[model samples]
Target: MTDQVATTEAPEDWEPSEVQRERNEWRRRRTLRSAVIAAGSTLLLLGIIGGLVVSSPGWERVQATYFDWDKAVSSFPAVLEGLWLNIRVMALCAVLIVALSLTIAVMRTIRGPVAFPLRLVGTAYVDIFRGLPLLLVIFLLGFGGPALSLQGLPTSALFWGCSALVLSYSAYVAEVFRAGIESVHPSQRLAGRSLGLTYGQTLRHVVLPQAWRRVIPPLMNDLVSLQKDSGLIAVLGVVDAIRAAQIQTAIDFNYTPYVVAGFLFCCLTIPMARLTDRYARKKGYHGAGGHL
Candidate 1:
C-alpha cells in the first residue's frame, strides 16, 4: 500500500522547473505588452485622422461629391445592371477555373510515364498566368482575341471580360488544388489500396473529398480576390460596376456614383468574407474533434 501511494504521489508532484516557468511568464508578458502597444498606436492614428477631418475645409465638398444619397440613388438602375454583369462574369469564371484546375491538379498528382510532361505543361500554364498581371491578361484577351482568329467567341464587352477572368483565375486555382491534393496523407492512399481500391478509385472516393474540404478557406479567399479583380475588366471597356460608375460620374462631374459603386463591391464581398470565416471555424473545430 505504501509503494502504491508513493507511485501515485510521484506523478502528482511533477511540476515544471522554475526556469521553464519563468520563461513562459516572460513570453506571456512580452505578448501582452506588444498587443497593448499596437492597440495604442492604432487609437492614436485614428484620433489624429479624426482631428484632421474635423478641421479640413474640403471635407464638405468631398462629402457632397462622394456621399450624397440622392445622386447615388438616381444612378441605381445602371449600377444594378452593372452588378448583374459582374455576377455573371464571376460565376462563369469560377466554373471554368474549378474544372481546369482540377484537371491540371489530377495530372500533376498522377504517377507514371505520363506525369512528367503533364506536370510540365500545368506548371508552365500556372507560371505564365501568375507572372503576368491580371490587367495584362484582360487586355490580351480583349484586344488580341480577333487577331488569334478564335471563332464563336462573343464580341460583347461582358464576354471578353469573362474570358479573361477565367484564363487568369484558372492558373491560381490550379495551384490551390495541387496544394490540397498534396496535403492528403500518403497512409490514407495506402490504406485505400489495401482495401482493394484502385488508385483512381481511392482518389475519387477517399482523397479528393477530404482535400476539397481542407481547401475551402483558400478557395473562398481566391473567390473574393477574383471578385475585386473583376473590376479590372473595366479597362477592357466592359460595362461592369466600376465602368458604369465611371461613366455616370464623367457625365455628371460628381463622384457620388463612384462611391455607390464602391459600396456595392463591399456589399458583395463582406457577406462572403463572413461566410468563409464561419466555415473555416467550423472546419477547424471539426478537425479538432470538437462539437460543430
Candidate 2:
C-alpha cells in the first residue's frame, strides 16, 4: 500500500472551464455593445441640439453678446482678482458658521430645565434666520449697520455683509448638526454616562465624533452653496467676481464677462459636486441613478 499511491491535483496554470470562459466573453461583448449604443445616442442628441441652436436667427447676436472671446480675455484678470476676495470671505465665514452652528446645536440638544433658555434662544435663531431670505438679511446688515454709527465697530459694508452670511448659514447648519446628533442611538449617550462621563464630556468625546462623520456629506453640500452665494457680496459693492463682471458688462454692454464669470464658478462647483458624490457613494449612499 505504501508503494502504490496516486494523487490528482490541479496544474499551476489552471484556467476556467470552456463554459465559464464563453460566458465571460459574452458578458464583455454585451457590455461593450451597451456602452457603444449609449454613447452614440448621446452624441446624436447633442449634435441635434447644437445644430438647432446654431440655426437660430438670433444665434449670431447672442454669440457676440455672450461668447465674445476678446471680452472674456480682457476681463479675465480683473474677474480672477475679484474671485480671490470671494474665496477669502467664504473661508472666513465658513469657519465662523461652523463654530456658531455647533454651539447652537449643542445648546438645542442639551437636556433639563436649566438649558430651557438656551434651547429657546437656539430655536428662535433657527426660525428667524431660516424664515428670512438671505439676500434681505445681507441688505439689512450692509445698508443699515453703518447707519447705527455704533462706536468701536467697523462700518465697512464687507464686514457686515459677511456677518449676515455667517448668521444666516449658521441657522441652517445648526439644524443639520442637531439632526445628526439626535440620530445617534440613545444607548450611546447612556453608555457614556454609565462610564462616569459628564453629559458635555460624553457629547464631546463620543457623540460629536460620530455625528461629525454622519453629517460630513451634507456639510460639504452646504459649503458648495456658500461658495456660490459668496458672490452675492457684490450687492454690497464688494467688487467680487460678479461685481467685476458687472463692471465689464457696464463698459460696453457686452454680457460676455458675465458668462466668463459663470463659467469659472461652474468650474469650481463641478469638482466640489463630484467630490461630494464620491464621498456619499463611499459611505454607501446611492443617488436616483442607483449605483451608476
Top candidate by lDDT: 2
TM-scores of the candidates are 0.79, 0.92
Candidate 2 least-lDDT 10 residues: 1-10
Instruction: Give each prediction's root-mean-square deviation over alpha carbons.
Output: 7.4, 3.8
* Residue-pair clash count for candidate 1: 0
* Candidate 1: residue 136 Cα off by (Å): 0.3
lDDT of 2 by residue, 61-171 (tens): 999999999999999999998888988998999999999999999999999999999999999999999999999999999999999999988999899999999999999
Write down the lDDT that model 1 would get: 0.84
Off by over 4 Å in 2: 1-14, 288-292
Write one digit per residue (lDDT tens) for candidate 1, span 102-157. Answer: 98888888888867999788888889988988888778888877566667766665
